[model samples]
Target: MTIKEFKLPDVGEGVAEGELVSWLVAPGDRVEEDQPVAEVETDKALVEVPSSYDGVVEELFAEEGQMVPVGDVIISFRVDEEGDGGGGATATDAEPADAQPDSPASDGSEPEPDAGEAGDDGADAEPDTPSGRTFAPPSARRLARELGVDVAAVDGSGPGGRVTEADVRAHAEGDAGSADADAADAPEPRPAPTPTDTGSDGRKSAVSKRDAGGSAASSATAAGGPEPAGRETTLATPATRKVARDRGVDLDDVPTDETRDGEAFVTADHVRAYADAVESAAEPTPEPGPTDDAPEPAPAGGAPETATASEATTASGDETVPYRGVRRTIGKQMERSKFTAPHVTHHDTAEVDSLVDAREDLKPTAEAEGVKLTYMPFVMKAIVAGLKRHPYLNSELREDDEEIVLKGDYNLGIAVATDAGLMVPVVESVDEKGLFELAEEVNDLAARARERKLKPAEMKGGTFTITNFGAIGGEYATPIINYPETAILGLGAIEERPVVRDGEVVPAPTLPLSLSIDHRVVDGAIAAEFANTVMEHLENPLLLLNE
Candidate 1:
């Protein structure tokens, strides 16, 4: 069998990297050529990456939420050199450096005794695997690390005895129960330690718990302390240390079962279990009635003590979410566009009584052909006409080359708001397509964009962009230009308003327009002229037909 590595392919024109959102196929699963193996999120859109070889998946190199550069290997496949390559892959002379040979259960074959199971004299021998690592997927392993459980000690309940997330959680809970039982069987607890410091104000500060040491008796004594201090010497992974700090648990107070280099090895699970037990033991018992033992209530008008930062932090429940993927991509793009170019926005209103009538007349015809027609198609047609008259508005600024390239073809990007983030899917050759055709393409692109089914290429190569904030009942927004493109048009809700025509006041439908341009490329005067041209087409539908 030949092991072939699959690198992340370039999904768009200028995409240099992508985030591996998820894997569609797992290791050992059979896949055919051109079958989708993973979903990758590029700057433009989310795309499904397909496999290149017909084989069984061997291993995954990139984890979900990790950014992978183009041409970097993300996965590997094991292919049979001779035969149809339809069945599960068998063992070969060559093996991946990071992966071990599959066992009989993984290959769907009969089990056989391992060389380490017995010696020539029929005595037990050493194990085949020296690393002592357990079998589990990346997600399961991540869960184990988060829960501070040693996955190697957990019993796997999946195929080939693979440890799953549920298994890890179960093992952690069981370990916690065992710890509790052992604590219950210990001797009676000792008295609380004396306060070691007194302030000028006569307030007594409790001794720090971190110096209490690592014995079970010490842990029980320190559980009632006010503050936990850092340990003098604690051996733990960085992740475990972080978990301990987050839970306000001191490493010195947490008991451990394993040791490395003659030092107590602590895991996140140990810290968590210790924290839970301490919390349970620290619950205050309710007093049924007032007694001399209960402290006197604070004086009626006495001043209250100010809370410390740590106390306030614990009182307020705060949460943290990871900032990555599509949201981060949009933020970077917007920042670059805002800082790289000086933007100018021009606001205006157009009386689109004719445009409204034109769309209403064509709605029935569009519906007969199964197309959902909206005002966007008319606006797109009018925008294209305006671009033809003012070429600079539909151009790109090539700063490195110090030149402005006027695009002859009109490819307009439509800004779509999706649950993931804001995505712009470009409609190619807008000038050549008719009203119905434009509406159909726009609807299809918007639908796919929301469903995250759009390909990267479908969002690229736009000379101009249009955002209809009106669909959300917004008006006159100063939109940022899609970088490299010189301009973007924002459309607002079309509503009936008072207008004076032929020296008379009357109610007429008006459309609000806000056009933003890169001041480096198009002058203010030129931008105003382009806006005028677009408004003219909207006011007189015949002008659009003439185009």
Candidate 2:
């Protein structure tokens, strides 16, 4: 038997690292080749990492939630050397056996805490002696720095006594509160304090009072801003940090509701939200008019009404939700596309009376064949025709190469809104497929996407995209360009509207279309021409049969 170490493969193009979401196979489990051993979440998608050799699982080197770089040893297996010839079950990019693994485990159990990872309740060492190094996730450390809490003094409640963000917050508001109160009181003597305002009040006010005593407090302090160099402890992506520097905004001052591992994580949206809030607050407020609604006055005797549970929860503070995984990935992609490409949307209405009639006629035929037909297949056909006419619209701009690469194949991405976020599953070779074929594939892909069962490959390699906002009852929307792709088509609800025909106004069924193009690569004239070609096909449904 030979022991083989398997390195984490590069699951996506240009991906540098991935988060270990979970382990599908554990130690001592026998697995076959191509069997998924672990699930990893990359910036692109969530993918299952498969095993290369059939063998018994020996060890797992990474813990869940840990970010692992590509080419790092992740697992080990023991296989018969003679059964697989001289291949020996070693991964192509496997590291040396002597190389140190990340959070390596001897058995199917959590790794022991090292000096650097030591938490509270140091049973391994003397109680009086300091561990010297406080162990925590990056987020917890960032929170400690932000709240001015001494993490070493915080009693950890996490596994192995690791300090968490909650621990830091509690320590700052509870344990360190007396010290803060003493410091605040040292500046000025206070008269006899009320019993109601002694313990909890002093502790709770510790965080708020620091802000109140600081310059401009929250927004004003932020408006004045700090140096362009943001705080070292602030957690944000490289792109977000760059945006902060470009906007001359202090990242530390920009508030966020998202946290990672007990640290406040800032996104570009958070930065923009803060800026918008500041701008809105700075605007002048108009005097209330007689018709304006005002809050009801308190009852007599200067007393207020008792609040309900829901109201009390609302009054406490805004809830903090972690922004990560698929939603965060979607946000980053949208942001990149919006900022990188100059977009121009051309809106028009198509008289689809014939198209509607044609679909109705074919409905029975489709139903008999066990196929559910939708307007999307017809629209997809029309879009393919339009792309064939205007090849520039079916292309991508390679900025580094300074070239416009026109795609030969027509693969369309259908944007399906899932509970996690908006996911676009690609339907390959749309031009080659018939209406029935397209309809079946679209329905299957959409269903799987909503359930999050679609593989990573099904979500990539789209030449163009079609989003049906009409399904949700929208008439028109300036849809953002799907990055890399030169254009995207948004469909609006089809309804009967008054139209002019033969010099007479009559009601006709019309479909609203909004085509957004990358202005940098596609010209306005070309975009309009493409849209017109699409409408021409829809106006005459027979033309689509020829497709």
Write down the lDDT of every candidate, Cα atoms only.
0.69, 0.66
Over the full model, what C-alpha lDDT does candidate 1 score relative to the true structure? 0.69
lDDT of 2 by residue, 1-547 (tens): 3566788988653456777776655443445677777777665466678899865455556655557899987777755454443322242112222111111222222133355323243322211203433446545654654554545567788987787988988986785446544222221111111112112212221011112222222444355532122323344543455455444455666766554323455667766665555444433344579635765444222223444544666788866466766556556777888899999999999999999999999999999999999999999999998999999999999999999999999999998877656768899998889999999999999998776577767877889999999999988999987888989999999999999999999999999999999999889999999999999999998899777
lDDT of 1 by residue, 212-281 (tens): 5434334445656333324444455544655665566777667775553334556678888777666544
In candidate 2, position 293 carries an lDDT of 71
Q: With candidate 2 superimposed using the best TM-score fit, by how many Å does residue 402's alpha carbon deviate from the native? A: 1.3
